[model samples]
Target: MTQDPPRLSVTSQDVANHAGVSRSTVSSILNGKDARFPQETRDRVYAAATELGYRPSHAGRALAMGKSDIALLLMPNATFGPQLQEGIDSLAGVAATHGLTLMVRFADPDADETLRAILNLRPAVVVDLGVLDQAGRELVQAAGVRLVPQVINNESNEVDLLIGRMQVAEALSNGRRRLVYASLADWRLDPVGPIRLRGAEAEAASRGVDVTHIHVPLKAAGATEALAQVTAGSAERLAVCCYNDDVAIAILAAARQLRLAVPDEISVIGVDHTAIGQLVFPRLTSIAVDFAALMEALLRELDTNGYGPPARPDLRSSVRLVAGDTT
Candidate 1:
């Protein structure tokens, strides 16, 4: 059997013909400038466009409106973990409801080159998750593209602090007094590790609990060395709040090699609540961030900054503790 040719994309002209309106009318109605037109005409245009699966070309819109309906998500130069993936997926869904196309790009260290290429697309907004540098900000501002979370201040650190607080709270609930913050050895992979450490320290301090800090690499040897440091110079039971599930798992394995009883001698809590955390020998207690709620807060922030449409003001705390065998 012969394969059939691909169906051509439906265009504005097709929608206009189907709706019994001129191309200009279809364009105006689809672009949300339908107030001058009759409600019936607007309904017809929308219904026809939907029926024909018509998608307006971003290039055409950019030419006409000076900016495409693209929301560029600038990701940090780090490992893409489950939390980041889930956040991206959630943002894409949220952005679509605002008639925006979501595009993700790993933020390159070469701010000039990265911004130069991003500005070429003429994105309506560039959303950064705590990665854009001073140079990148200047470039995006010069290009006149709206950047979300405009201030680029310490507000983003609140999320990391929340994670830290949740982890420490869960560890304390398990009756582990000696608290320790386990950060990743690679600084580039953990830009917010220090903020998280601070949060843990603050929380622990409030309860009159002192927390030691240790850096653990992903490798077995590094984890073993870190575990040694964690257990050194103390006989009291310890609780470790890890940067992520991977780091927590590494510690779990190191504990097994050291023959340390989890939650008895060393309670572990992690972030991201990854699936593998549940699959491990002793299920890893982790922090689960409500990415949908987080994205909604972000969208609302953008709206408040006059970058997008108004969103519901139902922002809630996104951090929660997932109970498991480890804690």
Candidate 2:
């Protein structure tokens, strides 16, 4: 196959010659300010521009218009993860319909680097996933860009809340259910984890059942040791509520190693309702976290209300208990 040289850049002049009109008339017609031109003339200009593949230089347009009409979406950490990808998919779909372009970039929570990336963009709108630090926030504000944060839990109480409370409520509701909550130890300090633990504890106290929490350190090497500790802890009720599906699966794997049966010997539950959660044996029973709604609301906040409008959307998304074979 032969490569084609970029067609010599076609300009309004070429379009004018092809359409048999003055350059100013072509500009007026193309820019949609051609009220002075008759309908037939307008059509001719458009047809000629289309046939000649003439495109006006966007540099002039951008210079005349102060706003670039571009949005920068900032995400925390890696982009390849399933959860992040799902959010990107949802945002991209909505942005396309609105004639907006979404430029996604990973922003580190570090003080200096984070601020530089955000300030450089000067984006019209910024959607933050709580990945920015204090300095980054200041940079975003200084740029005159609106910031929209997605509050998934008690964590980073910066935006609207979407943490799953019903999951803890249900687990705590079962009077006979023995409750075991598991999560990474670092999460204990996170707004979402501790708040969720509180809900579980509150519900357990009301039911007159004791709740024991086991923390697994974030270090991968320590996971096995932590899992051993989790499974070894003696609980009468045997119902385990993990912080998320990742931890829940880890517990399940540990349980199998200990020769324990799921739901029969130990009932396991988790939050997030991720794809892997449903694929596991006994189909892990879990709380369906509404990530789609969370992302949608975050996007809407950036587009319409910006920051001061509202924390969450008027529409409410609920978390449901999926009674899988496990529990």
Measured by lDDT, the strongest candidate is 1
Best by TM-score: 1
lDDT of 1 by residue, 1-327 (tens): 975442346777889899998876776677665677899999999999888878778887788778897888887777545776677776766565565768888767776667777878899888877677777787787777877766665665688877777778888985747888898887464577878898898888888899889988999988999989768787888899998898999999889888889979989998888889989979889988777677667765555557445554433367778889998
The C-alpha local distance difference test score for the whole of candidate 2 amounts to 0.63
* Segments in model 2 whose C-alpha atoms lie over 4 Å from true places: 1-67, 78-84, 133-135, 150-164, 184-195, 198-202, 205-211, 217-224, 231-235, 302-318
| Residue-level lDDT tens digits of model 2 in 213-246 | 8875534445556656655666544677777777
Cα distance off (Å), candidate 2, residue 32: 24
- Lowest-lDDT window of 10 residues in candidate 2? 155-164
lDDT of 1: 0.79
Off by over 4 Å in 1: 1-56, 302-316
- List pairs with backbone clashes in candidate 2: 155-192, 178-237
